[model samples]
Target: MGTVRRRLAGRALSGSLALLGVLLVVPSLYSPTREMAVADREHGSLLSHQWEWSWGRVRVAGLEGVELRDQWNPFGLAVLVVLLVSGLAGVCVWLARRVTWGHVLGLVTVGLLTGRVLTTVAERLGRSLGEVDQGAAGLTVRTEMTQAGSLETVAACVLVVALVLMGVAAARSTGRSTLPAKLPGTPAAGTAAAGPPAGRAGPAGLRPVGEHLTTAPVSFDDAGAGGGGGGADTPATAGKPGRTP
Candidate 1:
């Protein structure tokens, strides 16, 4: 009963975790920019040249703007990053269950740092394109846009829930036996090499007994003795002898 209860609890936990993951995973894909792009494309509209960002000249007279601003979703980005990092962590934990929470945290931290670096690089590249020459003013606008927190917040919330679920799932899956079975000191089951405990003989070790016991000599010894038996009252004659031979 206890075993069954534990299994049921674990299953429930895993199910909840998976549900959270689904919720979070979806938000990462929810980029408002896609809708904005579709809208722009559908209308065959172009960005107003006067309206620009940190880089400036957002649109040419005849050229269409890519609506990069509309695509900006801080919450979505956060969720996406969290989902990706957690997924990678989960896979690593699954493949090598020895991984600790610190390991997973480190991975997430590094991933976030790398993402920041990339975002900075992108921002720099955007500036180089003369799209955001307004400098501080443009940066403020971009910051505000990123912080608007609507769709992006929802995505982030989902992502956070998913991450929590993944963490719980991973925790439940961790144990000594969860590690790769090939590790040293771990037994390789169902093979002859699986011997007995150290310093002890196993079943196969007793085969020597069968081979050695069969070679016992039953013949009488004392070949050097001569004229020792004094007829039927001899010292060696104790049991009844047939025909007194």
Candidate 2:
């Protein structure tokens, strides 16, 4: 029972941390500023010059300026998708209540890798948006991590810690099951190995108290010598006269 409680406690903490990381990822990962390129002008695409990504959504043009004032969640997208991928994985961990999901992690990482293929498309469209730059783009794209709670690295760290804790708890639980059947010097369970106390009957067969006699022993030698038992006497005197003594 104690071990169970401890495991549960550890899992609960891990789930909570994973949830927190996911929540953080819901906010803006990066804010991007883009200048109209010659090709864009020639093509008349008129895409939004500013935007940011969060909650698995995208904004462009007029939509881009909506939350621009929000210091922490400046609008951005692209490499910051790492936050989204990590966030999704964290959610899975929390839901499963487990930390040993290496497969899940690998799958998510592969997904992120595939998504990187879109980098070229984004860069061409002035999608300088990313997790690292954090808006060094001519002060035009600025973000504050404090208020928005979009510190990607910190959030990821918290999730990692949660995973570690859950794994440790699982390891301990497994160890308990693999322990020796019976420890040295420890009495075995059940009455199979138990024995009766001194003078007590054990494995008895027939007779009320087994096959023991209740009477005391007698000395046959003394009885034969006429020292401890009565017997016939003076037979010799009758046959050959008295000895006169």
Query: Best candidate per lDDT, number?
Result: 2
Model 2 regions lying over 4 Å from their true place? 1-4, 27-48, 54-154, 192-194, 197-245
lDDT of 2 by residue, 92-164 (tens): 6545644666435633543343243234233433433452331233223332233333344355556566556
* Per-residue alpha-carbon lDDT of candidate 1 for residues 1-245, written as tens digits (9 for 90 to 100): 77546644653453344334334334324321111111133344443322222211232122364333332445646655665565545434433435446436533543453343334334534543533323343221121222212333343344455445545544544553386759787656766475566655656535643565454333233541344663333334234455532
Worst 10 residues of 1 by lDDT: 30-39
* C-alpha RMSD values across all candidates: 13.5, 12.1
Report residue 179 deviation for candidate 2 (angstroms).
Answer: 1.7
